[model samples]
Target: MQSVDVAYAEEWKMDHGIMVPLHFLTPRYDMDIIPVNINCQGPPLTPLNRVWEFGKALRRACDSVPEKIAVIGTGGISHWPATPNSVKIVEEWDRDYLDKWLANDKEALLAYTDEDTLKDAGQGGFEIRTLTAISGLCEGKKGDLWFYEPIPIFSVGCTVGVMEV
Candidate 1:
């Protein structure tokens, strides 16, 4: 397993190489893959159990592929509850979460609910997707912190990091 902090999808692809079994997973709220649902109110709240199901599916996909199971988690720094220093706080939380994640413990990762998470870091709730991705990758195995870098811009924050299982 290997890890790298990156910003752009092209950069990640360039580094990891083409032809990898890539799985781009993002929070439905922040996800730009499909048309943005502007009519939808706040970001969609994902049921914890539903996320677990998706994790299981991801694991099955990796098993089927058997190699080059590259999972990319995108988005960070929530945008609700409006507060100062939210970006920094979110970055810190993300770092700590990754630290625990590397240890292969889902309890710590899954303990926080979407509401609590959003209230804690405002827009940083966006980071939840990253946590979910890490959880899926770790899959009960120790995740080694490979990289961590937080970028704050436009009153928002974006953190890019990776871990190896």
Candidate 2:
């Protein structure tokens, strides 16, 4: 709820900030949404800058939390969004991510670099970074894809998947 003098984005997102809010907005909460950040009473924590570090941290999260919390990973399979030219789909990178994710191959899945992700998927592929973070949160869980669609008009690949606790 950080804001300035005037109004601000009701939902300002960075990294994976939107996930917690989105999780509550779903029907599981009986349509009630809580837009607040929970403080764990520790030093200000920043998400790991690199994927490898992020991968290692998930195990700690799984061990620490004593309750069941569902995590949804939303993003894309592969696409170059906002391109005026023809669409480019990086099926290879997308499939690799999916495979590693399904197999719970933390090391391989977290080793992805921005360069590789963008080059193969495009700038819009940046959204997948959120999915990676979500993946870390879902280590021991299984995921089910709700939907995946490639929009040629928007040059975007949109997908939504859920991992349960």
For this target, which candidate reaches the highest TM-score against the unseen true structure?
1
Q: Estimate the Cα RMSD of every predicted model relative to the unseen true structure.
A: 10.3, 8.4
Clashes of each: 6, 0
lDDT of 1: 0.50
Candidate 1 per-residue C-alpha lDDT over 74-129 given as tens digits, one digit per residue, 9 for 90 to 100: 44444432456633545676666667666756777667676676666565464465
Best by lDDT: 2
Task: Give me the runs in candidate 2 sitting further than 4 Å from their true place.
Answer: 1-30, 34-69
Clashing pairs in 2: none
- 75-142 per-residue lDDT for model 2 (tens digits): 55566654654377665666667666666566766566556665776665555555665666666666
CA lDDT of every candidate: 0.50, 0.52
Local error of candidate 2 at residue 70 (angstroms): 4.0
Q: What TM-score number comes out for model 2?
A: 0.57
